[model samples]
Structures are given as C-alpha cells and as structure tokens.
Target: MFIYASPSVERMYGATVDEVVERPIQDSMTPESFQKALQVFAEEMALEQTGAADPMRTRTIELEEYKKDGTAFWVESTLSFVRDARGKAVGVLGVSRDISKRKAAEAEKERLARINRQLQRSDSLARMAAAIAHHFNNQLQVVVGGLELAMNQVPENAKVFATLRKIREASRKASDISRTMLTYLGQISGARCAIDLCGVCKNSLPQLLASAPKTVSFETDFPQEGPVVLADGEMVRNMLANLVINAWEASGEGAGVIRIAVDTVEPAQIDSRHRFPVDWYPDDTRYGCMIVEDHGCGVIEADIEKLFEPFYTTKLMGRGMGLPALLGILRAYGGCITVGTALNQGSVFRVYLPVFQGKPSDTMPHPVSMMQQYPKNIGVLLIDDEDMVRDIAEMMLKRLGYEVIKARGGKEGIELFERHHQSIDVVISDLTMPGMNGWETLAGLRAVDPQVVVILSSGYDEAHVMEAGGPIDPPSAFLGKPYRLQDLSRCMQDVLGRFQKPSECPGDRLQNALQEMPDGAFHKNSAEGT
Candidate 1:
C-alpha cells in the first residue's frame, strides 16, 4: 500500500507514504471531520454486520486536504476493518479517490446557491419599499418639518440646543433610512464615483453610533490613507449601517463593544476565487477594505459558513435582509464582504472593495431629494392609525402654507374626503391597517371621483404585487410608506402632472420609442443576460 501511494501521498502530506502508512488513520484526518467520518463508519459497520443491503455502507468520505506547504485539495477515501482470519476480517483495506472535481462542483453549487438567495432578496426589498412608503413619507415630513419649524426657535448657543440636536439627528436618521431603503431597491440610481476609505468610515461612525443600543460601546481606528475605492456613497452607507446595527443587536441590548477599523490587503493569487467575503463581487478591481469587528456572542461553528446567505440570520428578530442587502449593493459595485468569528469572542466582518484611481466624494447627497421645482402649497388629507404621525403631518402641511385635514382611519379619511374631495387636491393614505386601509380607502375615494388625485402608501403587500403579470392598477400616484415629505410631494406632483399633460405623443417619449425600436446589440445583451 505504501509503495503504491509513495509518490502522490508524499506530495499531499509532506511525508513519504511509508511514514504515513504506519500512522493510524486518525492521525491523517482533521479532528472534526475525522470524528464525523468515524461515526459514519460505525454506522456502516453496524449495517454490514446486520446483513443489511445498504448502498451507503460502500460510501467513502472524501475531504479537501492541505500539505505542510499549505497548498490544499480534495482526496477520495474508504476504510479498513479488523477481525479474525477465517476470511473473517483480520485487517481492513482502505481506498480513496482523488475528488478534486467533485470538490470544485460542490463549491460551485454553494456559490450558485448564494447568488440565487441574493436574487431572492430583491423581493424582500420590493416588499419593504412598497410597505414603508406611507410611513416613511410622513416620517420625513415630520423630520423635515420639525427641523424647519425648529430653525426659527433654535439658536446656536441655547442650552436646549443639545436636545434639539438629538431631534435633528433622529430626523436625519429617519430621512436617511427611508431614502436608503429606496436606494437599495434600485428605485433610485446613485452617482458612481471613487471615495476615500477612512473618510467614509469616520462619517459613518456618527450614524452607527446613533443606532447602537445604549449599553453597547463603540470605537474606531482608521488610517488617513492607504487605498480608495470606487463606490456608490449611498450604497456603501447602507452596507455599513446594516453591519453596525447587526453588531449592536448581536451584542445583546448593551453587553458588548463593537469596534471597526480600515485596512488594505493583497491576497495570494489562489485566494482570488474565495476572496470575496460576501462572495458577491462588485467590479473586477482589487484594492480596498472596511473591517467591521463585533465583540458580541460569537457565531457558532456551524452557522459561520452560511452567514452571508440571505434570510439566514442568527438573531431571533432578524428578517436576514440587512446583510444580504448589504451584499447586493456591494456586488453591484464590484466588491465583496466576509465574516469570521470564534465562539464567545465575537465576529469580524470584512468588506473588501477594489480600490481604483479616482477620488471619492467627501459629502454624500443629503437624504432630502433636491427638487428642481419650488414646491407649491397644496391641500393634503392625511390618514394614518398613529397620532404622532398625524399631528406631525398636520403641523408640516400647515407650515408649508397648505391647509391640511387629518383622520384616524381609512373610513374617517373617506368621510373627510367625501365632505371636501373638491377642495382636497391630494389624499395621502396608509395601506396596512385593521380596516379601510389605503388600498380599500383609495378604491372608495376613486368611486367618489375617478379624477381625484390619490397617493397610495403601505408598509407591505400581502400579495406578490411586483410579480410579472401581477395585476397593476393605474393609480395616479404612489408614495412608499416611510417616504419623506419630499418623496410624497414628488409623487403627488408627478401624478397631478400626468393628469394635466398630454401623453403618447411627447418628443422625449417619441425619441425613447425610436431608440428602443429594433436596437439589435442592446437587444441581444438583455435577452442573453436575463
């Protein structure tokens, strides 16, 4: 046996086959994998002794193995037995197959599964986008209106400034999250540019700190420069936000510390295939990294391998969207994220973004949409189950020089609209509620006036609203829940503008039709890509 394996086994184990042959098989296997194989062998032995015709008894446990030089690969395997000699097993025979191809296939299968999971997350985002529209829009209106209202009363030196600062910070968070959600869903496209590595980290700290649980302490260590990466500012922020929030949540309300750092690395050529921590490669470059380390209860050994998988969260409340969404955005930009952890010590998530030549922007676009049109004061009827939201919207619209109407439910909203639909130019309603939700309320409103401008908002859809061939109604406007006032106003203006303008004959529309009509090269790519 040793002579037959002398050359190859020597190459694989950094030892002569003669040396390896004398050692017990246990010495040749990794502790964990060895134990598992031993258990399988025991089961196989039992089945054979019972005269059971089991195919699994013939199965061999192949494993990827590493030599002392650190090069690694797959090996086929089998087992030997011990017994008395009347053809009664005195010893056993061991056989193994070189299974590199099978190992490669397994890895490829894993990669494809990861990608499919990520694609599946597109629906989660669509759900969140549609679901939070109303909530987000109204929240933004409050935040923006609050700041606008406080702008008059707040002074730079006042003692109340500290408290005001919190409100502003929270409002900023509210607006940013709403916009960030949209950005994740690709509802909005972002400017692509190169950005500073540490600068993005520093700016992100403030928000990350704001979101952490009160008990969790945070720290940062970022060098001024090493490498810069081309990335979408909003997308990067979203990824960082999710990671930071995850760390906090894992840290358990307030028992742990989360530390983040930035560094640059260049891995060996062999690491390229596995380089992506998130496995969703952005663009093809290889340059930058953002290291997010959390000292929360570390991930279990079993869960570590599946950490980046979509919908695979260790947290009880985790919908598992955050990390996967983070991965999607990074992948779109030609980057990848990775996770590493030791039990009880916590996890370190490393985000690798290929650095490029261009310079990154210092300031991100403000969460507020920069509308070209100066907004005109228009009457808005606000309907929501929550009071803080209603009061908030009421104060905001009134301050904007528009009369406002408020209602607690869809029914009340319909009543108010019935009494004043002529004067009410816009109806802002939430979709998910106990009764008379936004969709139901809009149906009632449309019955009153098919011409009445309507904005539908919701936090989620019970049905597959975005599925291909899903029924689509021609609502005049849609504002996703959690939209800022700017988004709400944008939808309202868009819908109203569409109603006022002529369609199907505009020069731009005509130009688009001409451009899209029989463009062969562009056509081929779309068909092949999807």
Candidate 2:
C-alpha cells in the first residue's frame, strides 16, 4: 500500500510528493535514523503483541533526517500508530518540524555557560592569591628588614656577615615568589607607561638567554620602528623573560630555535585568528603584537585550556606562575593572548597590547651612581602596625643619617604628625593597618597639611594598592615592602630630593653611628624591647 504525502513534504525533504509517497520511510532516512525508527517501531509492536492494557499509541522523538540533496538536519517528530479494523497497529504517521536552529542555539548556550564557569573559577583563584600574597609579603617585610639591619651591624669581611648575606639572599628569593603570585593575581605595583616592545625584548634577551641551555639557539625579529604599547615596562620584561625561559626549557636538551618578533597589527587581523572580544581592542583598534615561537615539546590539546591557570604545570620543576602571570599582566593592560600548539611539534604564543599614541622617549634616564651621597638631617615619620617592621625601618633610617619618629598605628601616626608636622620632613606610612589604614592616614595628613610629603609603603604590589584607590592623590613616591637597604635609600633620596635639596652629610656617618654603639648593644636592646 502507498501512503499520501503533503505538499509540505517537498519543502521539508527537498522532494516532491510523488517521489516521497512511493518510497518506504527508511529510504528517505540515514542509516542511523532508519535504525532508530525501526527500534521505536519494534518496541511499539512488542507492546501490542503482549496485549498490554495501555499500549503506546503515540510517541515523540528527535533524530536526524536527510534531504534529497543529502544534507542532514535535526527534526522533532510525533508519531501515531494507525490501527486496522481489529485495532492492531499496522502503519505509522509522523509529523516532524525542523529543530536545527534550536539545537545550534542550545549548543552555543552551553559553550557560554562553560566559559562563565571558567571565569568564575579564575576570579576565585585570584582572590585567594591576593590574600596569600598580602600576608606573606608582610611577614617577608619583617624578615628582610631585620636581616638588612643585622647585616649592617656585622663587618662586611666577617664570616658571620657572609652567612647573613646568604640568608638575605634567600629571603629575597622568597620575596620574588610572593611577587610572582601577586602578579598572577593581577596585583602589580608598577605604573603603566609608554614602552617600546622591541626595546624590552632586546634589553632582556641577554638575561633570558643566559638561563637557556647552550644547545638552544635564539632568533629575534624586532622592527626598527617598533610599536610602542601602554604597559608597565618591568612587567613586560618579566613576561618576556618567563616566556623565553619556558620556551628554552620546553625545547629540552636538543638543539631548537626560539624566535621572538614584535609588530603592529590591526585588531581585525587578530580577531580573525583568535576571535577575541571587541572590548579587548582600543579605540584605534591597532595592537602591538609580540610573538614568541619555539620548536619544542609543544602543549597538547587537552592541556591548552588549563595553561593559564595558576599552579598547573607539566614540567618537573615548574612553579606554574609564568604563563598565569603573563596572562594577568595582559589582562591588567586590557590586552589578550593566544596560543597555537601542536603536540611534539612546537608552540607559538602571541601577546597583544594596546598601542600607545605617543612615541616612546629616545633618551633613557641616567642611572643613579652608587657613590651618590644621601642628605643628612632629613626627618622621617614612620607609621606601621607591625612592631618588627617599625623597629627595622627605624634602624635603617637612623643609619642613613635621617631623624626618625616611630608610630605604632595610623591613628597614632596622624596624631603625632598633627602635633609635630613641622618636625616631620617626610612621612613613610604603611598601607595596611588595624584602624585608619594607610590611605586614611594619608588623607588625614593631607587634610592637616596639603603640602605633606608622603611616601606610601605597602607589602602589596603597587598595582594592587593603586587598584584599591591607594594613590588617588598620588604620593611623592612608593616603596614596595621587603625592600633592600639600597632600594629604600634610593627611594627616600629621590622623594626627598624632589622636595628639598640634600644637605652634605659626612661619608662616614653610618660607620660613626655603628661605632658609637656599645658592645652587645643588640642583645641589650632585644632584652629591653621584648
């Protein structure tokens, strides 16, 4: 027997009514669809044959159907069992509507949901990283500052001094780890400025290559008129260094080439390859792109998505912060990164930064001479909640020939400053405190005297503090915690020099101060201080 076919059947299956009506239903379906239809039919027949009280009279299912041209599309079909005079199932009638658009929409929605979950996880990890970096940095400040003071007291040539130097060096390595964690958390302390991408790469190549194995070779393609980007120069340098090191390590012990290139590209060109969001591009829509390529044991497809996550690594000695920190830096600068990888072949990483409008300065600032003398008679008001930090900072300031005033907390520091603002030539306040934190203390001091010379100090990175509105008014200078004696000295001198001329101080002032101390002075002070 032949079944009737509607005119709409032609529209659905790209076949005329005559062509569809004469053929069996299975003839028009793919093998998978035909098998599925047979299974459903067999199930209904079995129920009917068993004489079930409530047999399946109608059912709905989704499946793939083919057109006359062999194109496939999804269909949701409702089938009814046609019965004979004895009420036995004989034929089938199905009404189906194309659901391909709906299915595509569902797939897109699922993809978006997955991306959202990934973003949420990244956010959670960032928050945890911030908390850890803040506390660890604070503890490091105490350790490092104390060690610096102790080292100063010991003679440079003494064996004890050598031991202390090693301890100090180890402490600094720990501080670097903290900084890496913070950077991955998008809490960088440095301010963004116009940077020549090529210049940073060229300058950092020596250091990066020094860490690479001798078997590996390096090639660079930096254009003479390289694009300048709006980003922190130090962060960029660190990012490049990490990437180059990662490439070198991945290349294994075999001979391989690592190539670095910097060029200017349009956002459209980048989007065509990477599909980044429009918001990632600046108004000009031009990007300064830096590409690092290596012939190495490349990342596998399965691990590519997890590469930017913190603490995810495959190497034996990998800390896993390198790529994640690179990601953080790009995100902080409103930039994007993409990776092209093939297992056992190689990898190419493209970093895109917003191109700055102005040309970078041609002249580099003069390096500070090591023998430059610091001014004496400068007064410093130090505010910190940590007792160890206060003591160590006080010791360092006194050694530098500066008059030091110490306060336990921000509130007390403000009170002291109000009473002795004239005597306090400069204020060095810690950003984090129990009550009246650094920002609040700065505001209070500013209210008392608009011309107050304040240097904001924080264990947190400058970017993190600034993100929390710590530098709204802009301090005279910023001092990162866990700093060395030389770093602190230079920061203070630079800040003070900007406000007033440095007075001539005796070259032997530090030695004189150390000599004046009585024997076992450190032990005596420790007993009384405790």
Which candidate achieves the best TM-score against the true structure? 2
lDDT of each: 0.62, 0.77
Residues 26-107, candidate 1, lDDT per residue (tens digit)? 6566666668777876776676677644433346677655555655667887765544644344444557656778888988
Model 1's TM-score against the true structure:
0.52
Q: Can you tell me which runs of candidate 2 are displaced by over 4 Å?
A: 1-74, 77-95, 189-191, 198-224, 244-259, 272-284, 293-302, 341-347, 363-365, 368-377, 463-471, 501-530
RMSD of 1: 13.9
Candidate 2: lDDT of 410?
85
TM-score for all models, in order of appearance: 0.52, 0.77
Stretches of model 1 off by over 4 angstroms after superposition? 1-17, 32-74, 77-85, 117-181, 186-195, 203-219, 225-242, 248-257, 264-279, 282-286, 301-325, 328-334, 353-530
Q: Which candidate is the best by lDDT?
A: 2
lDDT of 2 by residue, 1-530 (tens): 33887789888889898987877777677789889988987887777778873645678988887888889888898988777888777788888898989988997797678677777887798788877876787788878877887887789999999899899989989998888887776677367777788888888888877877889889989998668888778888888887888888889988989999998988776743332321244455689998899989998876877888888888765578888888877777888887888988998888888888898764445655556665555667889888777887877777676766678888888887776676567899998888788889899999888988998898677766777874468778889988878888888877766775345342343234334434532111222222
